[model samples]
Target: MAKDNSRDTGKNTIPKKKGRQSAVCANPLYPCAMTGAASALAGISDMGVIIHGSSGCYYYADMAVPDTLHSTFIVQDEVIFGSAERLTEIVESVSKLYNKIAVINTCVPSVMGEDIKEILADYDTICVDAPGFIGYFDEGWRLAVRELADSIPINNSNSNTNTNTDAPLTDLSKDSKGNIRVNIDGVCSMDPFHKGSLIEATRLLNLCGLKTAAVFCHDTYESITHPSPYSVSVNPDYNCADVMNRRLNAGARNSTDSLLGPDNVLRTFEELSDRLTDTEDAEIDIDISKIESECEETDEILTKEGDRYLRRHDPPRVAVYSTYAYTEFACDMIANYMDGEIVHAAARNNPPDSDLNGGENPYNIGGICSLHRIKEILSKKDFNLIIGSSFEHAAFPDSAFVGLTFPIRHRKMLYDRPVAGIQGALYLMDEISETLENGNKKSN
Candidate 1:
């Protein structure tokens, strides 16, 4: 058994004010818990995820998740009587196709309380009770990760000892060539930048002489069950490293870092490089100089580009709305690189930590959720640019818009564009500059 160093933080419980009956009931910007659970589980290529609920639940989850999904499609009769038989039939069929089956219980079936575990006792299936009323997308995602963590087989063969007392523990999984592999967490299939961010993070890891071991919910069941001890995240909100470490006893040290912004990317990689080299038994040589050089070059390019944009037009006073991590990153980029002012920054979900801005929130208002609240804020604020999803664009169609969040219906994103590593910083800045310039021209 792995070491259990986890304390009861009550971090998983849903907040009272942010529940289903909250102000976000009307025109909720983010998806519900069911969709979030499906998105996380469906990302596993080998696992067959079944939404054990009505057609509406199944369709909504299927639409949001890019990967293949299954459903029991419980009808009116099943609701009144019981969904156990219907669920069993689907699980039986799906069991043949996949190595493992995961059933996500939606609102109706969850309320039925028919003992899903007992019904699927004969088959190899994992049941996750993530109803729509539980919480928002992030809540559902975390619940699924917690459930998955239970299935991960603990490996006692790997030693958790650190030779260098000053250095952080580096008991990470390695690849065929003996390179330390790092797991990339927070890559959900529903997010538009998922593909691009995954590629960018992998590229940066390779540049620093590290291999990508497992993508949190995106990789295979085998890979996900056996994750690397060391991890880095593209988005901090959907991160599962802490949960994994807490659940698993062996090599369960917190070695995850965030790579959301330019500064975070540089800092995270630098720290990772230092930890690897500090290990006395670490034979694989890592060179972080190349990463530093590339980041510096990218920073110089961003400064020049930002300066060029500022010469033609006034800095864009923007309203940013996304997940907390993304919202912060957008606000930072606009303010730091473009010298723009953030009029308002709204997070779709709650902040991961207590500190909303680390005492540097440039925006007048922060931490507001729901489309109703956002609309109210937009009515008062005067801003040239809006950074969010289609909901924001629809509400304020006249504003200069950049689709950074989900439900991006205005434009078709055929290419896998990133928003994470050095390339990600460049791509994001490029988009912001072009959008600002175009919006300025239209206004003029």
Candidate 2:
């Protein structure tokens, strides 16, 4: 976990703030709590998700989440009376199609004060009261994870035993082939790289002689509920294994290691290899050399590309705006590999005090969600390169840009591209180098 870099009294340290202030302003870049919950829950292939809110709320979430989503579509008539009938109608309809159903409450429906659990008492369903007014996307995602964890019956006697319920949940501690399984968390459907990240993480785990277990929000309901005790994350910011473990009262496992950057990927895999090797009583066996060798090759490629870029042009003075994890990774890559200067770094949401970066935030500001704030920062900072979403690109259309976060509208992504593994590191560097070189040429 990251330490408290906010307390550093260094001259270069940027002042830290608390919570998101964009709720008070307009044009907030991040999604609301309701959308976040929908994004997380909708990822389960066998779980049908219903957004219990207005049409606008339902539409926004439906568009943001790539997975299929149902909605109560409560109108003013339901609001005047109660949305119980509408919610139940949708839940009942969706129940027939899925093994499990999850309902995410939006701002209006949350304030309705109706007992959603009681309304759906006849059916086995999960209810998460994630109103948009409560907080941002991360909060809603956490709430859904907690609810999902609570629904599963923890069996201490035999971890592999099937539930007596009609839907038999599989124990994902090991696959049919007897390979050790590791859950992959932080696979929210809203993230553009979610699919690619899942594939990359699974590949890396397979390279270490392990198979993937549950993939947080992306797997089936049965698999998700019975994930392996151990887990890893592609995006640490949206990780839910810790929250799930806390809810399950399962003692902390050596999980939550992230594979966001080259250094992180190497360190995380190496640590996993050592732990698996040291467990004498366990049936696990892995070669650490494979992980080391792959990382060395990736590092060589990055070094060569980075050097090539530097030889052609001076390192870019860059500003990054994204989630805390991505911001940290981008800064580290640019500053260390490309020898660029981080003029400004801003996180769309307020990052947790501790994270995988060990609290070493290169951010000059945090909780930057407003368009006005982004424009203000861009106008003041003398950055030639911008690393963020389309919002940041629109804020300064002249600067060299790389789309690393959500809402990347300027370009089309036809392939499953990652921003989390060995390929991800190389992919990011490739974009940065090409974008910078092109921008320089256009200027000349």
Provide the TM-score for each candidate, comma-separated: 0.89, 0.90
Candidate 2 on 1-444: residue-level lDDT in tens?
A: 333232112233333433333332124477888888888888889999998988899898877889999988889999999988888888888999999999988888778788898988988999999998876777788788888878887765555522222221224345666778788987878888888989999999988878887788888877776666678899988887766666554454427788988789889887776666565455566765777888889999989888988888888899888887888889999988999999877776666765323565555445566556567656877878888888878777777889988888888989999989898898888888888888832311
Candidate 1 residue lDDT tens string, 1-444: 332211101123233343222423223468888888888889999999999999899998887889999999999999898987888889989999999899999989888887898888888778889888777777788788888887666665534312122333444456556568888988988889989999999998888778888798788987776666678998777887667655665344447788877678889988777776666676546788888888889889989998999999898899888877888888888988899988877677666544533544445324444566567657988898888998988888887788888988888899998888887888888888888888733411
Pairs of residues clashing in candidate 2: 2-355, 2-358, 2-359, 3-358, 3-359
Compared with the true structure, model 2 gives a TM-score of: 0.90
Off by over 4 Å in 2: 1-27, 161-173, 355-358, 440-444
User: What is each predicted model's overall lDDT from 0 to 1?
Assistant: 0.77, 0.77
RMSD of each: 7.0, 5.3
